[model samples]
Target chain A: GDKVKQSPSALSLQEGTNSALRCNFSIAATTVQWFLQNPRGSLINLFYLVPGTKENGRLKSAFDSKESYSTLHIRDAQLEDSGTYFCAAEEGQGGRALIFGTGTTVSVSP
Target chain B: NAGVIQTPRHKVTGKGQEATLWCEPISGHSAVFWYRQTIVQGLEFLTYFRNQAPIDDSGMPKERFSAQMPNQSHSTLKIQSTQPQDSAVYLCASSLQGEDEQYFGPGTRLTVL
Candidate 1:
């Protein structure tokens, strides 16, 4: 079984629409980080959370350690948002390497 | 801050050859990590260093894979007698300490044929 699992392996969105990606963790994750891998293959950090929610511009993320899940919400999706979204979780505590989910491929079309 | 930097964005090598990938962490970060991504495996953690000291490498293959952080500024992952299966995008990341937001490099794409 995967330690971190992401839902809807792939997604297709229309411009100006909204979508949400989810991650379920089998491990007792202490922290969660969301990243967007652009077409150029560079990972852009979107959010880092610990059992809380954060909003940045058109993006918002929430992590629930107790429930062992995390969510990333994209509002007003744009073509630039087309990429693979990955969520990684850190188990236990300090210095632990992150365990990444398979990732959700997103394509926003106009 | 220049963020994490990885050299040789793309490399092609014949099987049985050697490949050395370099990573320079953020100026003040103390923890560095290495990961590999492949179409079949998605993403896998290879190793990690804290304060320039090897902390965990459980994910690294014992045989041909080796990593070192000789100083705070840089680290290197060397693969000996590389095989076709070794082809993947090697990513380097850095964090403030052991548990913080990690910033990743552009990644080094290694192809062994």
Candidate 2:
């Protein structure tokens, strides 16, 4: 079983629409981080969550350690939102490197 | 400042040949990570370095994969014998801390024939 399992392996949305992405953890996660891999292949850090919720612009993310889950919400999806979204989680403080889940590919069209 | 830098955006090698990929992390970043991305497996952690030392290479294949961080700025991943299965995009990323939101460089695509 995967330590971190991300749902909605792929998603398609219309411009100005909204959607949600999720990640379920098999291990107890202490913190979670979300990233956006744009079409140019650049990974931009979207949010760093610590068992709570965070929102920036049209993007919002939440992490629940007790529930072992995290979510990314997109509002007013734009063409530029088409790319891959990845979530990584760490369990403890002992050199606990991040374990990433399979990314969710998002495509927004007209 | 220029973020992470990686050379040779595209690489092609023959079967059984050796391939080396280079990455230069952001200045003053203490942690660097390597990952291999494929359509099927998505992004797989390959190896990483912390404070110019190997932190964990458990994700790397013991037989043919080796990685080293010679200095604070640069790290290299070497494969002893390349195979078709090794053809994937190798991505490099760096973060101020060993575990956090890492900044990534544009991946280097490797093709084997």
Candidate 3:
């Protein structure tokens, strides 16, 4: 089974609109990190959460370990938000590597 | 900070040739990781080193692929007998020791024809 599953494989948003991306983990993830991969193929770190929620500018993210799921909410989408959003989960502790989801491709336009 | 640095932003190689990719981790970061991304595979972990030591390499191919971090600042991923299947973007990331948040590099695109 896929350790991490991401929903809405593709998404489209209009400027000023809002959208949310999700990830469900089959593994017992202790930590989760969100990343935005731009068109240039560079991954920009977005959020790193243990539990609860975090808000940064127009982006907000929540991680619920009990439910084994996480969500990334984007408010007032802008063209720069167009990219692939990926969520990676780290199992257990101690220098372990992250297992990434397939990712959600997002496109924003005017 | 300059973040992580990767050499040969793009490389095109012939099949059966050798390809060497380089990575320079952020200063003071002890954990460095390698990953491969392709249209078909999305993202796959290759290996990771902590403090110049390989902690895990379970994701690396058993043959033809090797990664080494001889020092804390730089690491290398070498592919012997490269194949078209090796075409993908190789990404390097580093983080503070034992931290979950990893900052990624711009990635090195390898094309084997």
What residue runs in model 2 are displaced by over 4 Å at the alpha carbon? none
Of candidate 1 chain A, the 10-residue stretch with the lowest lDDT total is: A90-99
Q: What tens digits encode model 2's per-residue C-alpha lDDT throughout B61-87?
A: 879999989889899999879999999
**What is candidate 3's lDDT per residue for A57-108, written digit by digit as tens?**
9999999999999999999999999999999999887767889999999999
Higher-scoring candidate on lDDT, 2 or 3 = 3
Task: Put down candidate 1 lDDT per residue, B17-102, tens digits, no spaces.
Answer: 99999999999999999999999999899999999999999999999999999999999999999999999999999999979998
- Looking only at chain B, model 1 earns a TM-score of 0.98
Instruction: Please say which candidate is ahead in TM-score: 2 or 3.
Output: 3
RMSD of 1: 0.6
- Candidate 3 stretches greater than 4 Å from native: none
- Candidate 2 accuracy as TM-score: 0.95
Predicted candidate 2 versus true structure: per-residue lDDT over A1-110, tens digit per residue: 99999989999999999999999999989889899888877778899888899999999999989889999999999998999999988778755567889899999999
* Model 1 misplaced stretches (Cα beyond 4 Å): none
The clash count of every prediction, one per candidate, is: 0, 0, 0
Which candidate has the highest DockQ of all? 1
Query: What order do you get sorting by DockQ, best first?
Result: 1, 3, 2
Clashing pairs in 2: none
Q: Model 3: what TM-score? A: 0.98
lDDT for each candidate structure: 0.96, 0.89, 0.95
- Candidate achieving the largest TM-score: 1
